[model samples]
Target: MAQTDTPGEHASVLRLPGIVLGVGLGGFADGILLHQLLQWHHMLTSTDQDRIGVKYYDPDTVPGLRMNTVWDGIFHTVCWLAVLTGLAILYARVTQDRRRVWTSRVLWGWMLVGWGLFNLVEGVLDHHVLGIHHVYAGDGQLWWDLAFLLMGALLVGGALLLQRGGRPLALPAGAPGPDAR
Candidate 1:
């Protein structure tokens, strides 16, 4: 006996679930480490607390002013929304391209690239030199900040690697050789 392909198996493997898993993992790291472990008060804001009608104090002077996990929740919420939206798009695309060999891999690669870009831009503008935020606002925050950027780069690079490796595995049952396409 021979195994037969199902109607929706490809879409099931490639769509909403995949996006949710990838984005959830990445978002959890940001919420837990960057927003919670590090005392970065303003994780989602672009301005100083004083300028935004919130109190401000030098870490030395302020006694209890430490990391705020509230913003972590907010960041996580946003990440969830992004992942949901990406999942919707992935579902649609995969449905339309169910028979296409590279559709799923390409979709996954694109999502990874988008997530990395988000991290790089947000990390630099909000957490780095602007001082709007930090991965850890406490003492010696530079290394944490660098690590965040490095993680983003790694995500993007890993996606590219997957895209390359996926090509040979994407052929349909009776498809001709690569050169034919």
Candidate 2:
């Protein structure tokens, strides 16, 4: 990453905010769609004592759903904090070329990268390692979980390609920034 003696020009500094923002937003999308609207799974919906030795919480039951909902709310709260942190970082770093950076494909690409990372990490931890919940519970749930990871990988790949096309910001590290567009 090039440094123009300017903090905003630093490659990682510029990209970090966008990715963090994307992670939070992506998590919100997942929680809302899969957990709330679709009623697919909750924080501990997949727990089975035999498998993981954790008490199962049946999402169909009121008490069980209540517990799951509480955990889900906590997850969302963390995501909200992440979004705030990301925006705060962006507001601090991008002191110039506000319009350009805001519209640049690089920023968008970084955001996608963040979202993909969130999906990949969360899918692995929650759906696979922890087995707390699946993308969709019940039969063939593994397929759903795998599909989620695949989408994340695709998003990251596509985002990298998109970033390559975003000139100026996309310029190789150590290169000078192009004049304001």
Candidate 3:
């Protein structure tokens, strides 16, 4: 007889979807709040305003605004892809193992981790290292950058605590965890 269910086939599968979703949402939040709403920065806004290839565009000019808008569209596309990919992975995992609970502690914990990871990577690479953009590109930019990193650290730390405090979310043997049918 063929095996029907594989609950433990892929350990750590439950957290994958949440993490991806968080990462995508985090990206969306950054793009919306910082780039769109506050108008603090754009995708290619940087200190080196005259860089070749990816030249910086002023937010005031129509051509410059168009350039930044294009780059922003690209960024949003990537975030959208992340969400779709996460959903695909989640569907596959859920079908494979019906016991995976959507609201488990592990899922929430990893989601926070993923969001934090996004902020850390984006903040460090774009703001500090590459100078591509900062949370607020102006005098005392370092303060904003540090604050962003601090927020990321807090998210990661909080996630670890949540994961540690909760009991492992697993249905007991012979128990039906979810009803797909």
Candidate 4:
């Protein structure tokens, strides 16, 4: 038998929000903990700073690197952009598809997948092999890197679980019925 797909099946209302939330949080962690709190080196390099050794110096004693806060601003800007875009998409979906409200599971699942991928790639390339940076290079940085990897694994695993569980809530009104077109 040929199966007919419904709007719910084709439309993903939570996908954009999930991406936004994940990216926003990741940027937040990088800006707050890595940049502000622990004071690690920024990833974005400019021309002037590139000429000097600011990119590869200890955060504590590097004067040229200390004043360079452009990366921090850029990080926050990107985070806000992601979040705003997500919000816009979510709002549009909610208004347009008044019949069926999106499920939290879908949103969370999206976030998990996005975050997991980010963590996995960043951890492997930056933390493991390149050794260009670590979460906390001052004391027990290796352990921190390991923990970061573990966190990434957990996020991916949790997302898999959510995907397996599927949607637990009943479909909203006006949405296609379980047995209807």
**RMSD per model, one decimal:** 8.0, 4.3, 4.8, 5.9
Clashes of each: 1, 1, 0, 0
Q: Sort by lDDT, best first: what order?
A: 2, 3, 4, 1
lDDT of 4 by residue, 62-113 (tens): 5646544655676678778876876676666554333333445556666676
lDDT of every model, 2 decimals:
0.54, 0.79, 0.72, 0.58
- Model 2, span 1-181: residue lDDT tens: 3433443344455588989998998899999998999989888888872247678878788999899999999999989998998889887876655667767777788888888999999999889888888998778988999999999999899987776565554444554432131
In candidate 2, what residue range of length 10 has the lowest lDDT sum? 172-181
Question: What's the TM-score of every candidate structure?
Answer: 0.57, 0.84, 0.80, 0.65
- How well is each residue in 59-174 modelled by candidate 3, as lDDT tens digits? 67898888888998999999989889878877776553444455455566767887888899988888877777788877998999999999998988898666544343344554
- The runs of at least 3 residues in candidate 1 whose Cα sits more than 4 Å from the true structure, single-residue gaps closed, are 1-25, 37-67, 96-107, 168-181
Candidate 2, residue 3: CA error in Å?
11
In TM-score terms, candidate 4 sits at 0.65
Q: Which runs of model 2 end up more than 4 angstroms from their true locations?
A: 1-10, 49-52, 169-181
Candidate 3: count of backbone clashes, pairs at least 3 residues apart or interchain: 0
